[model samples]
Target: MDCLSLLEHVIVTLFLAVLISIYMNKGREEFFRILLLGLKSLPGMQGLISRVLKGEVTNFVKQVNLDETTKGGKRPPRVVIPKKGIPYDELREAMAKFKAAETNHVEGKIFAYTYTLFDEHFQLQKDCFKIFGEKAGYSENHDALVSLFHQAFLHENALNPMIYPSLRRFETEVVSMAAAMLNGNENATGFLTSGGTESVLMAVKTYRDRARKLFPHIKEPNIVAPITIHPVMEKAAHYFGLKVYHAPVGPDFRVDVQAMEKLITPNTILLASSAPQFCHGIVDPIDKVSELAVRRGLPLHIDACFGGFMLPWVEKLGYSVPDWDFRVPGVTSISADIHKYGYVVKGASVVMYRNEELRKHQIFTYAEWPGGLYGSPSMAGTRPGGNIAASWAAMRALGEEGYMSKAKELMEATIKLKDGIRKIPALEIIGEPCMTCFAAQSTDPEVDILAVSDVMETKGYKMEKQQKPSSLHFSILPHHVPFVEPLLQDLAKSCDEVKANKTLAKKGSAAMYGMVATIPDKAIINDFIVEFFSEVYKCN
Candidate 1:
């Protein structure tokens, strides 16, 4: 297409868009009309429009990450390869500095990312990590990236278990261990996924395929889950060709079982809930939902990705957690992350079914390939053997006794943290969170929760802002055991600051979070999110 012709088409499109926007949103209509006016007399209007969009979108995105992902709102220098090779020592020093600059999760300064007990404990996992591969190669200095033994199986792949039997054993043993934690029966079996999202994806694929065979007449399968179901389920539904009916939660933030049942149609293939949903960290009424699933003759998938490893130990600590595992009569499948409460490295989760028959649906196979037979357990090809090994090693390093001891400290800290939050008159926890994780909201309207998050960031505390009720998510791990009181001090101070200065809500980054929480027009918020991410990914 020629430039002038493209410009003419754009003009026509803008005119039509303005006319449509006039009815839906008067403000946007006027704004775009001004843009169109600027487009009229300008030479090379295409470049002008491109610059306008780049300025508008990238600026908002960069501003959003100013205090978070980026420093001082300036784009970081792009990394490029060098013509001359740098010494391994120089590279090690550079990487060590970079690693040093990372958030000291050991000091409990951050939340939502690293999950660990102590610095010394995690170094063991790092040592095991070297058994597979490290980008800079193994260092002779043991202390460089934590004491490393010998590196072996550097070229190992999990795709063919026959080739590397250790990878196969590691994965299967991890699955077995995860299944036992969730109270799986003798027949319960599953596969290792990259993480919670992929685990959820596999569950969706498995249940969808199962529905095809059991209920062939139903062409359009759907899933019935609570509104609080993790966004991974949203991704799963979008990726798989299925419809989802989201039932609202009750006042306590637990999914209303009756509402879920009401949404279930004859074509509903699976019923879904979380073992403490992510945002508020409240366990959905899985027992009640499981009963509903049994009555409806539908498969129930429990997303224990966040709470899977935490809940069993929480129960062992004598907390009265609701039955969410295989002990629940109708629970069919579960996905739990070994990375989260399991205290392993990133990208490891297990999705297990009630029995082997249900798990078979998750496997993929092809016989007629020219490259010979092809078979995959999950979505990924050439699965990393390191992840499987690291996960297994972490599990062995922390046996049942070790996990229970960690859980005791973790929950005790959570109790202290919850008590401290309750003491703060302006802030209140959203629900009775099952694990050390919970979301907090502003009880007083004068206090802007997002602004408090901004202040908390300044105080060197990482806070994940949530929108449903203008709250903040705290994923307290063992790292937080000693810092509970200190975090609460900062929290109280941040809330007071927000209350004192009413203008903080309109300040940097908080405005973006506030828009999502306070804005009634979800359509506009959706557009902002789409544009924000689209511009973020565009090359500078």
Candidate 2:
């Protein structure tokens, strides 16, 4: 070999040797994380990465309706406070005009985040909020008079419950009711959170604090959970300075219990599982994992954010739900959202613990300040009394029968939809989903699901595209039952159309999806998504 070539080989070898030493001493995850810090410094890498990401970001922005240029329509005025307020009628007109910009989701084609069923039940919440806001309920003994307080409770602060005793009652009752539904024992206690994310954050914080008190020697604590666990858990780890070890899911899309157990090290502070994971809608093998958690003497948190309200009813309906609740001995905590299937208004959830001992870690107290011996539960202060009131009122009104009825209808609709999808020649359900939510992927190699999604969009369905095995997400609601047959027909036609040409897969954001699938480096995809978000939020 030439002298120059021989010297290059020797330098590269020595550098690799140093990297190996760092990996052995500092650990694989940290070593790679540190190495990636200087990724932009590598010759030609930054430019290539940026170029690849720019095209993908442009595609994503356009796909989400952020068109590059305005043509015919006038821009909405970005209004600050006017010197004179716009009259009430004019303000109402502006509100209606803004609202008109959205798709007619009531047609049942758009499978968005919320799946509200009834206008009547929705009115109950509106009345309750107005009862708090303007000054309204489902009390078994008497009509829950929410309007008694008027705007007084709406303006009231929940931080000092002594002054706002009714809001306190609403919050505690909502928490207690959720605990009872999840089969939490008498000693089991918890606090109300703004939503599922906050509940998860608090749960993670509580467990981390507990580990600090118990295992003070472990400075760098970590959490072990299924790869399919909600991203909120990742958010918690990021905020709380905890490392995460995500165990891979099995072919069934359930977390492999053995793989998860292997990831649990001495530094692992907690274990997490989802009742039905968000990505594929498959429940992790929590029963087996709970046994491992018990063996390891580690806290296990079941995130039932999606299935929280429905699964209890599913069990009641004899739908073969796996054991994943407080009935299990090793489950130390659970995060359940009332906002979703609970049919309440937005932003209400419960974070439960086996007992107050563990929950005490989640409580924050400040005696050093002039704030006069403050103690707050969860991460939120100045809590909304309206959310609490609506949650309480809705749960009381619905009772078990109301929820059970809705759950049954939703299950029936989901089954019908799943059956229909199975009949489609080119499409198949992604996993053995535990609940009403599921995803559909291409059974035929020629059929690109993302391409099918673009077609479905043309048919007025707001289909969410999935990765890992390209699919389209479906979250079915009770009211969606009526549109099941129509959706199935459109889906079948879309699949057939996409499969026939194959070149159609190259059109629109399907090209973006194809590019994302081929790219081996995930950091580039991360950059693409970040850029997409930046473009999406820029003043239009």
Candidate 3:
């Protein structure tokens, strides 16, 4: 009787334990679900996720070894202000050593991240930067260089225009020049920004604010943009509490205007398209989109950041380009990077609006600050005067004639490169590219484009990999002009090698890219990328 009772009790105890464990697991799952929902509602959370997933966080971590922990348990050197300063020469030597590992972009082998120029033009910019480096536009220094800098910085932080009339004047002139090139009328007004990303951000922010004022009932403002529109637009939408409705693109990689129109709703605050999108370097149908915007009574923003400086000349050279600027009646704003094709050093772009009323929305001013009245035109608070000065100097130095000549050369080189690419039967251009920037895909299944990229890398050529339809992107610059034939030869060789060794597609970046591209659950991919970022940021 005692053994039977004990066995029954043990069985009951085991059953109770199993029941409890199941309930606890359910509770944990519910808790995680609630936590994830909360995280999704938070602003910039997706941005942080996207940044981590996009390899930016990993790239940053690779560039900086911030962790001090070491395997030997030794105290690592801390980066602190030295009690005694080192000699300038010694400091320079240290800096040179630090930079020794960086890619030699000047050699023209690298593409995707850099835009190089003629050595002489670069020298001119460097000299201008050095002269204006220390002087802020706020300073009253009236020397010619300072005066030029003052002009460049004037309207940038135009809250107090009286401080530097020259800055306002130069800024106006720069804006006017950009507007004229973009075919905008006298009503066009804009301000210089830090870069293309900032310019795009400002445009998004301005349109968002305008929508808030005009359509008060709209709770969730959204932007209609091509899938190929710069990712910065998505970032801007994330930061400003706007939703981005990405419209599908056609086989040409250009946004389908009808599909984009279908995505528009009453809450649609802005319509955007790229002038030669960054991925495939094909312009969206801005004319058709502009007509749609006009019909819908909405604002259209042309993100010509990459093509702003080059496309105008391309058109002037008798190349057929679609109407993409303010000349279109419905277009309200445009952002063009002076850094990309403008031949300006890496930190200047312009966002032009149809009128002052529209531009005012981009301005941020807080008069209630304890210190004093504070305001900012674009994203940054303390704008770099040197960037403005250098940009201005570059523009003025190049002039219309210089830019035209350079554009002609770049176009010719682009033609040569495209012609060479055509000669490679396995490789095909992604779309009908309108500018020097374009992408190419491997048509033959035996040759993986990503594998070709890896092979090209081994040949000392860096190429950008594009998804959707897997391909390789190239943005030709003055430096790339000389390397056009060489790049073509390398591309052909890489394609041949990849075609010969099908297994190469399963190695290096090709393997990673191919695997990620085929993954249905992007969350898993994002998690993996976030883990990569974590590993990259690990100091030890």
| C-alpha TM-scores of all predictions | 0.73, 0.73, 0.72
- State each candidate's clash count: 1, 5, 4
Angstrom error of the Cα, residue 447, model 2: value is 0.7
Residue 210 lDDT in candidate 3? 85
> Regarding TM-score, does 1 or 3 come out ahead?
1
* Top-down TM-score ranking: 2, 1, 3
lDDT of 3 by residue, 239-338 (tens): 9999999999998888999999899998999999999899988989888999999999999999999999999989888888888888889899999998
| Candidate 1 CA-lDDT value | 0.79
Worst 10-residue stretch by lDDT in candidate 2? 76-85
Worst 10 residues of 1 by lDDT: 142-151
List, residue by residue over 1-540, the lDDT tens digit for candidate 1: 999999989987987676677746777767667667756547898677767987896677556432223556653332211223334355345434533544444565653323454466655655565534567665543122221201122234678655545566667767877777788866778999889999999999999999898899999899999988998898998999998899999999999888998898989999999998999889999889988999989999999999998999889889989889999999999999988887766778999998988998999999989987889999998787656765665665556776788899988898899899999999898878878789999989889888999999999977898877788998888678878888999999999999999999899667877556677888988898899899999998
Candidate 2 local accuracy as lDDT? 0.79
Error of 1 at 495 (Å): 1.2
User: Which prediction has more favorable lDDT, 1 or 3?
Assistant: 1
What TM-score does prediction 1 earn? 0.73
Score each candidate by Cα lDDT.
0.79, 0.79, 0.78
Candidate 3 error regions (>4 Å): 1-164, 537-540
Model 2 C-alpha lDDT per residue in residues 61-168, reported as the tens digit of each score: 557665333465553222111223233344334334533554444666554323454568765655555423332133322123322222223444567655445566
Q: What's the true lDDT of residue 469 in model 2?
A: 79
